[model samples]
Structures are given as C-alpha cells and as structure tokens.
Target: MGHHRAHVSQGHERGGGQTHEEHSGSHGHGGHDGHRGHDGHAEVFRRLFWVSLVLAVPVVALSPMFADLLGYTVPRFPGASWVPPVLGSVVYAYGGRPFLTGAVQEARARKPGMMLLVALAITVAFAASWATTLGLTATLDFWWELALLVVIMLLGHWLEMRALGAASGALDALAALLPDTAERLTDEGSEQVPLDALRADDVVLVRAGGRVPADGVVVDGSAHVDESMISGESRPLRRAAGDRVVGGTVATDSTLRVRVTAVGSDTALAGIQKLVADAQASGSRAQALADRAAAFLFWFALVAGVLTFGVWAALGDMPDAVERTVTVLVIACPHALGLAIPLVIAISTERAARAGVLVKSRLALERMRTVDTVLFDKTGTLTSGRLTLVGRAAVAGLDDDELLALAAAVEADSEHPVARAVVAAHAGDTPAATDFRSLPGRGVRAVVGGREVHVGGPALLAELGLEVPSELGEAVTHGQQNAASVLHVVRDGAVVGVLAVADAVRPESRAAVDALHAHGVRVAMVTGDAQHVAQAVAHELGIDEVFAEVLPADKDAKVVELRERGRRVAMAGDGVNDAPALTRADVGIAIGAGTDVAIESAGVVLASDDPRGVVSVIVLSKASYRKMWQNLVWAAGYNLIAVPLAAGVLAWAGFVLSPAVGAVMMSASTVVVALNAQLLRRVDLDPGTVTGRAADSPSR
Candidate 1:
C-alpha cells in the first residue's frame, strides 16, 4: 500500500486464507491508499514531525536573517555561525530522508511528482546555505528557511496519515468473525480441530451460542440461529434438519449437527471477502487524475525554476537568481493536491461503515450523486418478504379478536407462511387446540373449546360449500385486489371472519421514497407481482414509475433502457434473480439483508433491511464529491498564486515573497484540506435525518 519498504505486510492468513498482503496490495499507488492497508504510517510521520520541529528551533534562532527580521542580535558568540549550518544539515538528512528516498524512486520510474519537488527544494536550500556559510556568497544563506520547510512538510503529512488511519474498520475485524477451531464429528466421536481440517461433507457439531464453522445444511438437531450479522435480519430464525446455515451465524439456543456443504473459499463468508477485494482492486478515476495533476505540477515547477535562474542571471545578479529559484521550487510542493481525494475517501468510508453500508466499489460511491433514477426489486427489498396480518373483518355477533384467537389456535401446529403469520399476530394467551390435522391445500382443522374450527383459503370454503357474509366479503374482496392472502375462520360450520395476510410494505419504504423525491430523483419499482399489486404499493409511496410483472431475466434490460434514455440509473435488489440487473446498472445497490449472490454482484451492500439506507448513500456521495473538488481547487489555485510570487514576479511591485512565507502557505493549504474533509464525519446518517416526513427525523 505504501509503495515504501516500511509498509510491512507479513502475509498473515485468516478466515478462509485471505492474507493481509492481498488486502494491502489493493490500496492504490503511493498517494491514495484509500485507507485499506498498513498499520504504522501515521506513527512514522508523527515521529518525524516532532524530531524535525525540535532541531528547527536551534537553526532558526542562530540564523542572521531570523535575528535581523525580529530586530535582535544573534546572541553573538564564538562559532555561532556554525550552529545554523550544523543543525540545518542534521534536519535535511534525518527529517527529509523520506522525501529524499521517494524522490529517487520517482526519478528511477521516470516520473516526477510531489516527493521530487520537495527533495529538490530542501537539497538546493541546503547547498546554497553551506556555500554562503563558507563565504562563496554573502547573501544566499537560508538555513532558517530550509529548517522550517522540512518541519512544516512533515507536520502536514503527519496529519494526513492520521486521518486515513480512522477510515473503514480494520479488515482483521472481518477475519475475527470466524472461529479458530471447529468441532468435527469423526467416526469415533466429536473432536476439536482447526478450521483448515474442515472439508465438504464433513459433519460438525455446533453448540448453543457457537458460530457455525462453515456453510452447511442441518443434518440433525434444530436451533434458532442468530443470523443478524450475516443476513441483517434482527430476529433469530429457526433452522430445522433441512434448513441451510451460513458460516458466521450463531446458533442461539440449541445444538445442531451440520454437514458441511462449503468450506474455505467456497463458503458464503469467503464470497463476501472476495467481493471487497475485487472492489479495491478496481482503482478510482479521481485518484489517477490527482496523481497526474501532481506529475504536471512537477514539470511546471522545474521549467519555472530553470527560467527564473536564466532571467535573473541575464541581469548579472547571480545571488538573487539562486534565491528566487530556490523559492520557486519550494513553493511548488503539491502537499494539498496529494492529500485531497484520499482524505475525503477516508472520511466517507468511515461514515459508510457506521451506517452499515459496505462500499464494495469506489466508482459506485463516486457515481451515486449523479444517478437520476433508482429501480428497486419489489418482493424482498421494498416489502418485508414475509406475510403480516394487515386487515380482518368479523360477523356482527363475533368480535375481531375472538375470530383471530380461533384462527390462531387452529393454525398453531402448521408451518405454512400464512399459518405462521396468523399464529405470530395473536397477542393474547392462545387457548390450546385438540385433534389438530393438516388438510393440505385446504388448510388446518382442529378442535378448540369443543368447537370444530377450520382456518384456510377459498379452497376450504369451496370444499365445504360455504359463502362469506357481506361484512367479511368486503374485507376479502379488497385484500384480493391488492394480492393479499385471505383466509377464513370457519367455526361450527358457520363463516365468521376473514383475515388478510399481505406482503407488508416496510414502514421505512415510504420515507425512503419521499426522501428520493425530495432529492429530485425518480423512484421506480420492478416486480414480478401483478400490475394491481405493484401499483397499489407505488401509489402508497408516491413512486414516479412502475415496472410490474417483469421477469427476472428482463430486469437488466430495464436498466439498459433507462441508460438508453439518457438517465443515470441505480438498481437495488437482493435475490439471485436480481444479480444480473445489479451488475447492469450504473450504480448497483444490494439492500435489505441481501442474499450472498446479490452482494457478490452489487457495488454497494446495505447490511440492514432499512430501505432508507439508500438516502445515506446519496448524501455521502454528494458530500464527499463536494469536498474533493473544494480541496483540489484551493490546492491548485494556491500554487498558481504562490509560484509567481515566489519567483519574484511581484519584484517590480516591491513585494517579493520569501521561502519561509511560501512554506507557511503550503502547510496551511494542506491543513485546510484535511480539516474540510473531517467535516464529513459530522453528517447525520440515522436513515431518518433526510426523510422530513418521518416522525423520527433528526436535525440536519
């Protein structure tokens, strides 16, 4: 990552053999590492700044120019003149070692940039000061300027390194999600072994509260798995003998014997790591452009330095020529330019991680600000992906709660989604049912309080030749039009109530849509659901467009069509079917406890199911882009102004800029960039902050 020998990646492998070297290697170039690599760069710069600052004090105090400017004598003493040169040389070799070596490497690579410019300035100043100290020239001494320049440059770099260190959480934290050892069920009995010993078809025993060692299917036993880390679902899911379990999920309350279906690189967790590594491998366009800017500045300063010396020499003032040339080169260092994009990227990544957003692709983050349309998958993304009780109607004699209690008791032993939804919705104590029997497609029949109760759909009613009363039919007809699942509570051969189980649109979806509308971005829904069902959801959320009954294979074509119409599009989805479209869009976002295959294809992955996480992405992209441009403008503009002044272009106006003053301008420009980037951390991304219509909105 550093492009320096001190980068120090020991190649430690953990969690499916992903080595730290692979992680560090993806960090782009020497300048914009993007905060994914290395550990001690900030400490190195911090140490250099303090040591250089200390040595600079003696050099500055002993300089005749420094004492003259302050209207004080140089503490006249024997060998005092030797003090500035001696301390100044020590600062150049020790404090400027990093720049000196970096400049050499850049020269060998046939490229000139910030490091070369910095090294040239200090080296020239060092030579000129020594020449003057030895009586070659009386007025070219610049020991104080050289000392201050090195100290200030080191301080700027120290702050830049520290900012990057706080970026996205350490990759080691991802590795720690896996256990070092696993319990393998062998021919004799269960035995403890390292994770590497695991292979396909190997049976492993997972105890209560233990993480699954690898992705596998439950061969024996059952448990409610806490998969919030893997799927972003808050509730624990029950995994029986046939359910699949991902590696990194915890078995919360019981034991499970699993047959490993995947291990090492084949595991789902390993797939997530691969997606991140690939994203980092694809470098950023802005980073490359900044590097080129530094290259351009390098050549510009070199030509300026050469021309300044030639012009001043033609006037027969060689002492003035050397001083002006040194000033021109020193002021050309691109400290702010080198730090601009990297600092913004670092802060953006930090904020994204806190908001449960994983930026798999840097380009996606950069492009989100320009997206004009966001197309979302309807089933699991905009909706809750599970049936929820939304409506119920009862006969005149029966209360709604009474009808609900009867249906819940009859559906208690069933595993159907509709049955589960009904049972879960009951808040009161459920009276025990007797003689429970599954009626297959018709429904479930059981005896509760000596009454034969049946809970089912229209098929159950048809078999019994029953008709719903007008009161229940009103609710049933409305629910059917919206594609909700309707079931009847038939007790004592009489139809009493009808309950509606629909794919509940998440409460956050409405706010998510409203926020997008406020940003002037059109919200669109893509679903395989019927037209009426899709429009029902679209109208409720104030969506601008809808694409219903769209087959999964055709979803990519929709994204392509949007692009064809000259609008930037973003696709958000979470199914294997959504993978193609996620890859086809300009910015692909995988949201809402997404499937692994979808994450593999998406540029950004939201670990939480909150649809409002989409708003956070747009907010981050626009804010970070604004900072990058601001820093670049200030850095480039400062050089344009400072370079001319340093070259004595203002000499006719009696206002020639000195080297110490140029050094201050360079350091101040860099500090402004760093501090401006830090402001991004203050942005609130609570998922409610942007949606003003939401009750939980926070201050901007």
Candidate 2:
C-alpha cells in the first residue's frame, strides 16, 4: 500500500488554497485605506489634544471642583463662570469630534465600538455640566472633568494611530525598491529611459552597483546579483549569460545586458508588494474575535450605563445617576480590547521581516503555532537540485581512482548533467580522448589512450549485450535501490566499473530536519521523483513520512489528505509546481528562491532558501501568539475589575471612582497592552543554532 494512502484518508478544503494576490486584491485596499484615514485622524487628534489641553487649563482653574481638590479659592472675576462653560464647549466641539463622528459611523453600521463608548461618556458629561450651569439640576459642576476626559481620549487615540502607521510603513518600503529609470539599449547606444517605458524583449544595460530594471535573462556579461531585498538571501548570486535575474535586484559587480522578460506589475517585486499588502490588510481569527468582543462590550457598557442611571436615580438624584453612568461608559470603552491583537500582529510582522520571514497572513501566523507536521519539497528544498557523483565501484583488476579517471576522460566532451558529474568526480587530470561520438539513446563513445571506450546507462548495456561482472553487481544494485543513476564504464567491450550519480543533499537539510523533530514537529517530504529517490532522501534526513511520485497537480491533494487525517500541516516549497500545495496547507512557507507564483500562494515567505527558516517561523509564531494571549487576558481582566468600580459597586463602602480616575485606568490598560505587545521583540529568532547547538551539525 502507498504510504500516503495508509496515513491519509480523504481530501477536503479547510479554507486554505487562496493565493496571495487573491487575498490581497480582495482585502488589501480596505485595510490600507483605513490606516491612511487613521493617519489623518491621528494628526487631527494630536492637534486637538494640544489645543484642548491649553484650553482646559483655564476651565479647570475656574471650576469649584479644582478649588476644592487643590484647597485653593477661585479668583473672583465678572465672567469667570462663563469661562468654564465657554472653554469646555470648545474642548468638546473640537477635541471630541473624532469620537463623535466615529460613533455615528459605528451606529450607522449598527456595530458600536470603543468610539461609541467614548462618545457616550463625554456627551453625558457635557449635558450634565450644561444642565448644572443652567440651574436645571443639582449636579456638581463637571466642566473640569469634561475637559480632562476629551484631552486624554484624544491623546490615547493619537498614540495608537501613530504606532499603527509606523507598522504599516512596510508596504511603502517595499515599493521603493524599484528605481525610477533604466538604461535601455537601442541600435545606436544605451539611453536612459523611464522604468515604465521598458517593454518585454527590450535589452537593457545594467552597470555595476545598479539594480535590474525588469525581470529578464542575462544575454551578455556576468555579475554577482544582490537579491537580498527580494529573497532575503544576503549573499550575492552569480549570474552569467542565459541566467534569469529579477527586477529590483542589484548587480554588485560587473556589467550585463539583459533581455527583459517582465515589467511593471508582472515583476517579482510587485508580487511581493501585493503579498505584503494582503497580509497586513487581512484580518486574522484573533482579530475577528477581538472585534466581536469589543462589539459585545459596547452593548454591555450601554446596558450597564442605563442600569447605573436607573438604580442611582431611584436611590439618590439625577446628578448622582448621571455621574455613575458617565463613569461606567468611560471605564468600559474597550480601548484595551480593541488594541490587543492588532498591536501584537504589527510588532510581530515587523520582527518577522527583520529575521527574513515575511508574514503574508495573520491567520497563517496564528495557525503556525499548532502545526503538527511540516511537509517539505525535495528538489531545491532538501537537495541542491544538481547532479553530483555519489559513489564509485571498480572491478578487482582496477582501482576506484583509475575507474573514475577513465570515465571522466571519455565523458568530458559531453554536456549532459551525468557527464558533468563524472568529470567533477575525477579530481586528478584526465588523459586526452579523440574521435568522440554521441550515441542517440545510449551515452558516449570515444578513443582514450588509443583504446575504444564507452559510457552509458542500462540502455547502453543492453545495446552492447554487455553483462555486469559479479564484482560490480552488488554496487549496481545498491546504487539503483538508493535512487542513484548508475553509469557503466566499458573498455574493449568489457564492463569494468560503475559510477553512481544523484542530486546531492544540502548540508543543512539534516540539521533542519533534526531541529523540527526536536521541536516535536513531524517532518515529511513530498516530491515528483521516483519512489526510491524520495525514500532515499527521506531516510537520510530522518523524515517521518514520504509522498513520492506525486505530480504537481496532485500535490495539493496530498496536503488536503494530511489535513483530513487531523494533521495541521505546513508545506514548504520553492517552485511554481508547488503553488497549489503551498496554498492547500494550513500554513504555506515559500523559499525565497522559489518562483513568484509559489511565493504568492504561500502565507509565509523565507527570504533565504534555507529550510532552517521553517524553525524561525515556529519560534516567531509561538512567541507572537503568547504575547497576543497575554495582552488579551490583561485587557479583559482590567475591564472585569475596573468597570464595576466605576459603576459605584463599592459606593456603600464610601468608595467611588471619578470620571478622571476612570479615564486614567482606561489609558493605563491601553498602555499595558501596548507594552506587552512590544515584548515580542525580545524573542530570539536566529536559526543558526537549534536547541542550543550549532545547526550545521545534526549528530551533536
């Protein structure tokens, strides 16, 4: 039975498989537009706060409450009483406008939030103070309280908006990577043109230290390209003729002529920008839960305020009822609750980027914490994706070095991957070969040292009717079982030796797998390679599961199958073929060197093509989730205790919280939430060491 069939049941879509562009286009604008409006709103609040603070000084000095609290007599003046009302009205009109407008919008949407609660609190104080001034009520003057409340709310919102603005600036930073101009090559010479003017097939000249104008293949010259901004690979990659280069990547040294393949929105940089925008804009489950809680709190505070007014009015007077109601609303505005998750998300995302992990979805980051299995793609992920000589077996009459030298001399004229592997394996110099001739379905034949020799696979062996001698039979079987392609080297029509070639495994692969196991996450590998090839790689890395011979289209089915079997799977890959699988997993992690389509489908992107980045994602996800929970609990706990106190629950014991004191408590709770979210920055995300040991060696 197939290994996947034994472990996986049936496939079902669990709300995964959405591409980054689809998620971004659907949700990106709404969030950024909201943030832009918040930036404008922040500026308004900041200005209003400073002005209101100045206006409040005279209003508080002129009030009886201020004189009584500070043991000072109000200066006698003809119009001092009017000063308090005039300045208090200005503070309410200017400083409280944002809350009032936000509350109106929230009410229209039929979803009141912190804005509505704040609006209600300040409006109540305004009405009660004006009623006292007009001799319609016996309430103590609340003009000083009203001034302080408006200023404080404005300050809180201003600080919150600024923090969010700074976090969202990442999108702007990404877009700024593209240069404004390009050196377009024409028949006469090179001419600088606007970046937008460069079209597909346009040849562009890229100088040393200049950025690539568009995604293209290098047609001439060579250079070391710095793709750190796009892929998070700090080392510059060497690019020669026919090698592909991405737009926004810098050529560190040497000049090149590139044939543009893509420009404008089609470039990889544009795709990354869209992904970042989408992730920042998309709302996560935690954020949605917080929203629901805030909405519920709005209704809860409204009902509590109403009850406080009714109960106090029945027991005391209208003045006492209004005072208790205003305090209740002020204390239960949901400011902390509203800030809990978004602050954590903003800080974590910024930190993730610094560590070369790009979070494309808040929901993905949250889901990463619960991932039980991490499925890795084999080619370009576990292996180097390049052929290399793995082993050599020689007959009793010949040594291993002699066998390799003979094969290399014959295959040196060939350009096939297997030929290159043979030539690379022979460290010493090779004797000259002559009359080289290529076999159509077999391998190559040539004259080396005036002796006829042939090199090929099983097909050549069958063609020549050559049987492997007993001495080399066991080596051939072992090579075949381990998925290494065996090449037979024959001289004078006699089989003399065998050379095994395979895609070499990366040195980091073993360490990466061990690290995941240490973290209690099951490691699995999926590849389109044959069963033996996949099994061989899985065994070397100590992978728990292997899905071999999987077609690109069926990769997602395997992911869904794992999910159906109750596994929280994270698929990591680096190719266009891996796009569907990347989207189908609970969390998709794309290697930086992967195609743009795969990156677009993934929720998290590892800037470097390093599997250890998978470990970084887990570390960041768990740390971020912990901070979110801490802030949530603290915010919710603060409300549980402070709201009741503000509603006069301890009034019989001669203790009551004034509106100013309640405002202070509310602001303090917000500050605590902000500070707790900031603590996520302290998490160590470097993946060079795993479980306190160097990740370069897994055995240790």
Candidate 3:
C-alpha cells in the first residue's frame, strides 16, 4: 500500500499536476506517507549494499576454493567452526536489516510481505549453523549462500531504486525550472531579489532569454516568447505592451518591462506543478490492488516457509529441513514481485515522455487501455482554437479577391482577434486608415481611401437601413448552416459582399477520430460552443455523439455519465476550465498548451497542438499493457515451476534438480521478464497509422 502511494505521489508531482483540484484529488485518493516509506526503503537499501558487499568477502575467503587455490592445509582453531556462524549473523543483522524492519512494520499493521520471507530465510540459516557449532549435530556452512542471497537482493533493490529515482527526478527538475529570483525595477535601476519577496503591482524588468519570474502584464517593451513549457504549444508568442506573460515561460530574443500581477505559489506554473505532484502522490484503485497483492504474497510465502520447516523437521532431518526452509525463504523473496509492476510503470512512463506525453497520474495510463469512448473538447482538441476564413460570397459586381482586400482594409485598424486574422489573410502591408468605428458585436465602419466602408455581421447592414438581395440572404444562411460567422461588407450603406469565418476543424483531427473508430472506439465531442457550432464540427468528423455548450462545472458529469453507461471514456481537452472533467475520465489527455489546471488535470500532454497525440497514447497504452501482462505471466509461471523443481518434486521420477541448476533457472526467468518488458520500446505507434484510414475519409 505504501509502495503504491509512494509511486503515485512521485508520478503525479513529477508528471506535472500542481493545482488545487489535483492536490485535493490526490489527498482524497491517498496520503503522502507512502512516499515517506519509500524514502526509508531506499536508505535501508544503500546501507545494505555496503554491508552485503563486505560480508561477501568473508564468505569467499571461508569457501573451500580458498584452501584449494592456495595449495595449503590450515589448522582449525578451537571452535573456529563458529566463525562462519558469527559472520552469518552479522550479515543478517546488517545486510538484511531492512527486511527485518519491514517485516516488523508489516506485522504491526496486521499485514506481511516479501520482507518476512527474506528475514525468515536468513534467520533460519544462521540459527541452524549456530546450533551445529554448539555440538548438537554435524555442522554445515550455509553462511556463503546467505551472504550471496542478501547481496543479490541488495543489488536488485538498488537497481529498482535507481529506476524509480530516474522516473521521478525528471518531474522535480521541471518544477525546479521556475526561477527563484526576479529583477525588480525601481526609480534608479533594477535589483535582483527573491521571487517570493515580489508583490503584486511591483514593476519588473525581464531581459532577453530570461524566464518570466512571476505572472505579470507587460507595460513598456515587446518581445517574442517561447511558452511551450506552460502552454504545450511550440509556437513563439509575440508579447507586446499590455499583453500578459505567464511565469516560467522563456523570453526569446526580446526584453520586456512588466508589472507583476501574481507572485509566489499563486503563479500559474506553480499551481500546475503542485497539482501534478498531488495527483501523482494520491492513491487510486490500481494502487490499492497492487498493495493487496503484495500483502497477500507476503503472508502466503511466510506461512508456506514456516510450515515447510515444521513439516521437514518433524521427519528428523534438521539440516535438510533447514535447507528447505532457507530455499523457501530465498525463492519466495518479494524483490521480483515488488519490482514487477513498478518497472512496467516506469518504462512506460519514460516512453510516453519521449513521445511528448507527460503523464500526471499512474491510473490514467492503465485505464487508457480499456477506454471505449473518447470525449473531445471541441475548441482546442478538435478544432484549431483559432477562427479561419472558410468561404466567400460575391457581391453583384465584385470578385472574391477584390471583396477580401476591401474588407481587410476596413477592419485593419481593429484590435479584435477576428479582425487581426482578416487583415493577416490579405497577405500584404497596407497604409493606415483615417476613420474607424468598432461596432460592439458587429463589424467596424471606416473610411478606406475616402470610400465609405463597413465590415460586420449581417445585422450591421440591416441596422444601417440597407437592403440585400435574396441571393445574398441565401448565401448568409448557407454560411451559418456550415458553422461559419457571416461578415457582411457594406459600402455606401448597402450590402456588397460577405466573408464567412469559423473555428475550423484541425487538418488531422477528423482523421484521428476516424482512426479511433476503426479501432472500435466511439468518438464524442464535448464543447462550450453553441449547439450549431458543436453539431457542425461533429457532423464533419462523423462523431458518434455531441455534448454542446456545457459549462466547466458539468464537464465531469459527462464523463461519469458515459462510465455509468458502461463506456470507458477518455476525455481530451485544453483550458483551465476542463480540469475537473479531465480528472474524472478514464484517461485525461490535454491538448496543445494552457494553464496549470489543463496540464495537471490530464494524464497525458501532447506537446504539439494536434489530436493525433491522443491516438498515440491509446495505442501505446494498449501495447505497454500487453507487454506487462506477458512479463507478469512469465515471471509468475517460472517461479511456479522452479519452486517445485527446487524442492525435489521430480527426484523420484529420476529428474532431480540441483540447487545450482534451480538458481540458474530463476536467474534466467528474471532476465526473460526484463527483456520482455524492454520489448515495449520497439512497438510502432506511427503517426500516420494514428491519423486515419483512407477508406474512412475519402474526401481527405
């Protein structure tokens, strides 16, 4: 249980969940003490490594090989046979101390684990040899085997710890990237000070290539910034005076003087980091299962080993009984069992990272394998988030390009996003306009080269007492039906032409949906947009369902509803509002970039603003899960077969297995499991395969 909690905490915080919701969710799922125990385990493992390595030297020196190789016969000291027994006890106490400690802790909690088996094995071996030295019977030197087994366990644990540290350390590194200091501007010059000492409304000066130390609004300079870390989109954003720059974004090739608006943990990036840490630390259903399994194995092995000693000793062969007991203890050690799931989790996690998916929760990847229904947030997930021109309507006398140029000139002076897009589409620099009036919900009215010009929605034409032909009205209706925003261009108080713009579907999104469908996954679109807009996008993608105009509060409800209907849903979204829904789904995938909530709520983050990444995660999860299952089967199966063989089950059948042979077989099984898990790296999740099937979308 502690192991699962430890892994969860490490995974989330490291993955990038650092929000209030993520923190609360993690706490609700599980506490942070599991991680504390992991720390304890690591400390014990290090101490054991040195202790075991030391004991190994004496074990070799006491071996028969020592005397044979030296070609000398040595006199035995009085009661010198006790030397091995004393040294074996020292090894058990130092090299095997953690197991003993863990066994005691587990026993106190009314649970037991692999540590109990290890402790019992080493304890029994030492006790048996010690008794023989006391003149009770013929002495056997099991000190070598005991020392070697502990050394092997120490090495295994060290490797396991290294893997865990590597997986978790990356996340901590990301969180650490936020600079602790900022340059605060005063009347004379700027001074370097701790970011936490900064206050809202304080002016700050950021130089070229410096991260924004806190959330602030630019006031005196302009620059291009790479916000990829915070937003997940690789595009370089141009920040001018009055634009907001988030903390933790790299200032690329520009100097900016900004007024701080948020500081300390209130910053967006800090919140994201906190949320990720909390989500990872929290316990989930998957972790509960792992804990239960470990507890069960610990108890089963302990009882079996004890019963084995009792049964064999009652038959009057104490040394044979001790060997069997020690074998049970060594063979049933939970090292493999403890590592199996965590290793799979760690490898898969790193693989996802390389693929540009930052996993915030462990259960997210596991649950992705079972997701049958996918819900996408339309704005940033399915559509390009930015509106684009889709169609043009001709006036009675004007061509398409002529109408576009006139409209672009009229709207050029406007600061609205749509206006900027229209001007950008004209593809050339133009002279400044003389007169311009921005009508609220409508377009703008201006004078371009002294010719009265108007660019706005169709309602602007009616408000200006203009009359339009039926043909033009039909065009407007057609545009609206296709989910376009109809912009009427009126010159001299009459409607002359129209431009249709809408939040267009991404080029690869429809294909991604189709690919999912081909893989037997149902696609659904969930959006805050109006019914007509959402419906048009869904129809275009051939989606199975549409949930439109839903507020952020209700996002999670949709996921829960789908699950209640027996559909395992994967929700992909962007924006701070989608955090709850992302956390609620079977798998939470964040698209492009956004606030900390967006990154922390989701299990996977797509570095690129493309829907195809979701497909990559789905296919990868399936592949990784399959590999884990295969490894688990082989590891468990090998242990099952080898345990019986080592106990001499086949001796009467004239196929007796020696201890050395059994050890070789066990080592081979570990190698096989490790190799099988490594094979996941070779799985092909080609972007083309995830995009679409040709047969599904012939129009493309």
**Per-residue lDDT of candidate 3, residues 34-105 (tens digit):** 323334445656777877788776664564323444565544768554556677678877787766665665
Q: TM-score winner among the candidates?
A: 2
Local accuracy of candidate 1 as per-residue lDDT tens digits, 118-221: 78878888888898899987766789878887887777666655655543333335447778899999899989999999989999999999999888899999
- Please list the residue runs of candidate 1 whose C-alpha ends up more than 4 Å from where it truly belongs after superposition: 1-37, 66-78, 168-282, 428-454, 458-467, 480-483, 490-494, 593-598, 690-700
lDDT of 2 by residue, 576-629 (tens): 678899989999988754325225688888766668888889988999889888
Q: What is the lDDT of residue 659 in candidate 3?
A: 43
List of clashing residue pairs for candidate 2: 231-607
Q: TM-score for candidate 3, please give it.
A: 0.75
Name every residue pair that clashes in candidate 1. none
Backbone Cα, N, C clashes tallied per candidate: 0, 1, 20
Worst 10 residues of 3 by lDDT: 7-16
Give lDDT: candidate 3, residue 395: 71
